[model samples]
Target: MKKVLFAMALALAQTAWADGGMDILKSQCSSCHNLTGPAPQTLKELWARKGPDLFYAGNKYRKEWLVQWLQNPTRIRPAGEFYEDHIKPGEKHDEIDPATLKPHVSLSKDDAQAVADALMTLKPKSDLIAKEKIEEGTISKSMGEMVFDKFLGCMACHRIEPDYGGLSGPELYTAGDRLQPEYIASYIRSPQAWDPKIWMPNKHVSDMNIQKLVHYLEALSQENKNGK
Candidate 1:
């Protein structure tokens, strides 16, 4: 009787937590974020999106990172969520229209934790997550930068360091710390798998190259962590 009662109490508590999180998300986050499933199917739909898709947040994010980030929101994409609307051609390169990018709304620590927990429960792309495998590996920063930038041309749109590369894609310097390795690999292998109309191309990168990139991002995160 005691065990049964305790179990029932725990289950009820969990259900309440889930309900609270769902309510918070709907009320505070739904306007900008796509909390429901099915990523943008067409260019028109994609362009209409105001924030990153959270339907597959379980498959994409690191829970702890999400909690921390939600409380202390920072701009992920150098340009706004939709680069096309934010970018303007400059003499040397494309620049972000400062006025187009609005700051993300920050949550209190409790709310951040609740939202992160809720988001981690929304796993829509299990197949992609299941097939991914990453090793505990790393690369030298210089060599990794060479391969990612000079060879792969990733620097053309993604930054490996602060103010060092293009401003279109989400910055890569913090990728390892902010995203799941599996997600990084899966997205690199096929960006279209996650979002059909996302600006990122399906590079169809070789397994070898993908692994190298993952390791490079890990190394970059370590370098940042160590203040180097």
Candidate 2:
């Protein structure tokens, strides 16, 4: 009876620790977050409160940054972009309110580690190819055009000298000239890590798509200079 009881206890304990992510989300975050893609706010068509998308949660954050932000919620944007002003502070751009943002349940160091690991594993839809820079002279002008206009969806968010998508976010017409190829690639892979309150959604394109986009962006750099 004693041995059987011990085994039962061990089984229960393991089950409890199985998915630290589910625990954290259910215990403290599920009220505002969704495990899958963007939160579904199917209520009032005009004014329903939906949470920030955590579909690409893993790609968007550094583990250290995630822990710090979780323990103490801070206002990454002073004016607010998508969500409510849960942790807004004065006129300051970034501020954390410890009292209001305290952990709902105590997270031991191990628990915190487990939670972070689970969160970081969620990536966008993608199959990437890690390769060296394509031959500068290898790409033709027509191929680059297709990449920018169609495959990568660059035209959706940014405008050229003529016109383009919404102006809610930063302009990227001159991206190629202004930014390095690798930096551009990294930014596409994870924009949220750069800023917690990013307005752009992670499109989660494949690695091949990412590389094509980078190459095209670099090509655009030359066009930008000549246009100016």
Candidate 3:
């Protein structure tokens, strides 16, 4: 009898916690975030997107990273969420105007935890994630970089370091920490499957190259953690 009562109480508490988290998201994050989604179907819808879609957050992100990032938010996309808004034509190349960008709002520790918990519950189309395979073992930094830069031209859009690389895509210096390995491989393999009209091309990278890049990102994250 006591065990039954305790179980019911625990369930009720969890329900309340989930409700609180949803309330916070609806009030504070709904305007800029897509808590639910069918990813944009056209360039127009893609252009209208204000933030990265979170419907598949459970499959795309690591929970610990989400909790920490929510508490201490940082810019993920160098050109801001909407590239068309912040980009400017320069003498040599197009640049993101720093002045036009705004910082993401940070959540309190408790709120971050709650929100992370809620976000992790949203894993629609998880079958897509299930199909991805993460390669094990180490990758040589130089070789991996060669694939990322010269071979694939990834550095053309993504930043490999805080002050390095391009302005059009999400900074990938922290991709290892920010995303699940399978997601990283899957997204790189066919970006269109993830975001239909995204600027990222469908590279159809080979299995060997994908694994190499995943290992590289993991290594990069570790290096950043060590402040190297």
Candidate 4:
């Protein structure tokens, strides 16, 4: 009877926690992020989106990373979420002032935790991520760089090496540290499923290459972490 009663109490506590997290999400995050999504099917719909969808946050973000980022918000995308909207025609990348850009909403630590908890519960399509795992240290830095730049053409929009690559997409040099490996693979395989309106196009990359890319990212992040 004691064991049963304790188990019941624990379950009730978990349920209450989840409910509180959901309430926080509905109240604070629903405006900018799509907590529920089918992803935008067209360019017009994509351009209309104000923020990245969070329907797969559970699958995408590391819990600790999310908590830290929420409390101390920073711009992930250098060219803004919609680059076309922020960059004027003929304006150079250096010309845009970071201070002029709209900042992400910051949260208190407690609220951030609650929001993260809620976001993590929004995972969709478990099968998509079931087989994915990061094969760390499998790819050499030079080889990974080649795949990122030559095969994938990711360098066109993203910065793979801080001072290198395009200014449009988020920097990938830190992606390994910032994102989950499964999230990276899933997002690359089908970006539209995560954010229909995102500017990233589906490249139809092979499964083998996707794993390589993830491996490269993890290696790169490790290098950065070690101050290499």
Candidate 4 regions with alpha-carbon error over 4 angstroms: 1-7, 89-95, 131-137
Off by over 4 Å in 3: none
Worst 10 residues of 1 by lDDT: 135-144
| Structure candidate 1, residue pairs in collision | none
Q: What are the root-mean-square deviations of the candidates from the true structure over C-alphas?
A: 1.5, 12.2, 1.4, 2.5
> Candidates' TM-scores?
0.94, 0.39, 0.94, 0.85
Candidate 2, residue 205: lDDT: 62
TM-score of 4: 0.85
lDDT of 1 by residue, 42-95 (tens): 989888988989999999999989999998987778997788899898898787
Off by over 4 Å in 1: 1-4
Q: Which consecutive 10 residues in model 2 have the weakest lDDT in total?
A: 75-84
Error of 4 at 96 (Å): 3.4
Residues 1-228 of candidate 3 have per-residue lDDT tens digits of 999999999999887776788889889988877887888898888888888988788889999999999999889998887887998999998877999998888999988988888887888857878988775689888998999999999998899999799888999989999999989988988888888889998888998998899999999989988999
For lDDT, candidate 2 versus 4, the one ahead is 4
Judged by lDDT, which candidate is best?
3
Candidate 2 positional error at 102, Å? 12
